[model samples]
Target: MLGRRHLLGTTAGAIATTSLLDRTRAWAQQQPFQPEPGATLRFLRWSRFLEAEDRATTENIRAFSEATGVPVRIDSVWQDDVLPQLSVAAGIGNGPDLAWTLHSTPHLFADKVLDLTDVADYIGGKYGGWYPLIEQYGKRDGRWIGISNLVIGVLPVYRVSAAREAGFDSFPTDSDGFLRLCAGLKRIGKPAGFAFGRAPSDGNSFCHWLLWSQGGRLVDENNAVALNSPETLRAVEYARELASHFIPGTIAWNDASNNSAFLAGQVSLTNNAVSIYGKARADGMAMADDIAYANWPVGPVGVPTELHLVYPFIGFRYSRYPNATKALLTFMLEGPQYERVLQSSAGYVSQALHAYDDSPVWRSDPHITVFRDVAARGRPLSYAGALGTQAATAFSEGIVADMFAEAIGGQVSPREAVARAERRALRIYRS
Candidate 1:
């Protein structure tokens, strides 16, 4: 795996030599792919939260079509609905030729996706290399089944004034301090909140952080079910306590609920991508200046255990225009096209490639810089175990999120919640 140090330490001479060799190999092997005649493509992606991002994507598609003569039709759905749509497509073998979907989608549909190793190789060689964590989502058994596209940094978004009113001069860096801050915010009548429902991104992001930050794992390094442990119980118990300081009805919150609540001044704190802050500033809300960002508090694990939203572009094996799809993806990842999307995202979406780390958009604002290292520091959805069908199944089924929700909602004790989750996870991993 390529760590941050290795990525940063790569010398300019090495990159130039590697790029030359890659170009030579492509020429010798007649690679870089060519679109078949009369080929057209269809692409599906999650709906964009930022207008700039949406416009940039449309512009890129138009540019690709103009350059390659391969007309592309793009469609979008809500983030939570993307996986189900892709599943249906895979089952019927007649959906979009390519999709940009979130974590575990590639693993869940590994057998149905086309191999893109050549595409990945060319892109990574030309633009430094992919981040270490990105490989976990894009590759299956050393075969490239997907291209890791975007890393949505999921961190703490809070009101600066409200935090000061709650007696915090700065955001907390540890779980204990975080709990105190939450309690203080509650006392001031501006409580913190996090999604507990079946929100595909926000719910899983925070709950997984809660579990893993406490040194808990759903599976061991050997992939055995390991959810029933003191660490898990502690995490669940902490979640319960944290929930007491939350706004009412967070249990039913979807992916967009917290953003709505925060902007409406109903919640002082929440965990989300930078979209909340972006929206606030875009619409000129009064609270825009009061908004600030912070990384997740470190728990007993003594490190960052964040699980950001990762979007990977997967191509279905059933597509007749496989070559066109590959070529289009390659076009999108090139420096000019990729930088357009990155600058437009305003740090809402981070790049998975190491070369883009020097993008000026990251430093465009002080609050945005906190998200720059997310792709390097964040963990994959499947932590402490290999990512596969079992891990994907367990996460999509909301096993960990449900465990926290049940305990927080008073339906079960923390220990019982842990036990129930263990049974469900065991059933998945054992199969």
Candidate 2:
């Protein structure tokens, strides 16, 4: 916990005493990285859900620019658009010099991205260290291709009154109770909904949880296709039942659809990030007081099998100002700058580094506290298999999500859907 006091406390007529500040200063003195003359940096990131977060990031970029005397151009796009744009940039060896990419994206373009091991090592040593699961997302072949930064926690957000009406004293902790709750809600006319379409974060988060919670996986640890199995059939069957209780048009829902439906009171429950709650409170919506969050229900696996969105700061190897890019990345993760962004996010984004666990933001509100352990409790996108090009390809193509959607939409039987998903996984894994 890098508290605000530690970050702001200054020695008599001297610099701040923060360990990150002191260590970074020491490292700079020992091996100063000189930026190329006339270097400018371009950074692309997903547009923020919280306005304060965006403002804080802009401030950090401004401070970095002022300190380094290097002007930086920052661009933001919709969350789903980032990977496709980054893929194009990687393929053509041109575009933004750096980007904050989502899950397993760095793995997909590992060869096109700069090796960030040195940058990762510096930050990890100065801070507590990266969370355990971060290595799975940021590293490949023992080389760090990106700096795992923040995790967007996807959890169950529901209206408290609705849950009470559903006859549950609290949110369910297991799969069977969860289904009953949903069924109860639907009978009462406030059904729960989860994105089943091509939502980059929400769709993958919910669909992957459905599969993993039931002990189904796209691949085995050996990276063999494993989607066509009894476990997968069970998951699809469960999805079919679950989708029947969902609001209509969920099969076409994108990342923003559930957010819209939830906020508009069209759905009483949905799996989403804390941004929905943040938006409710920020806009003074009446439902803000009715909103509460809960951890995803445990399934037959008997452990937490949730997936979350991870943002990694990756620099392109083709960047003209590699040193400057590295410098900017290091600057952002420094305690003061990073802490401000986290604080402003209000727990919508969990820290990727373990040291920030005690940050005041997580404790600021009880409703948001459920997000604090996301990085610790959640699995990587490539769970039960290696995180690499193959896994990235399968995830990006949404094979698992599509399988659930296809089955729920009655385009195929559950078994057929599982077989189709397995066939798709085989194509990618065997390629």
Task: Give candidate 1 misplaced runs (Cα > 4 Å).
Answer: 1-31
- RMSD list, candidates in order: 8.7, 5.4
Give the whole-model CA lDDT for all candidates, comma-separated: 0.87, 0.87
Model 1: per-residue lDDT, tens digit, 89-123?
99999999989987878888889999999999999
Model 2 stretches astray by more than 4 angstroms = 1-34
359 in model 2: Cα distance from truth in Å?
0.7
Q: What's each prediction's TM-score?
A: 0.89, 0.89
Poorest lDDT segment (10 consecutive residues) of candidate 2: 12-21
Candidate 1: 10-residue stretch with minimal lDDT: 20-29
State residue 316's C-alpha deviation in candidate 1, in Å.
Answer: 2.4
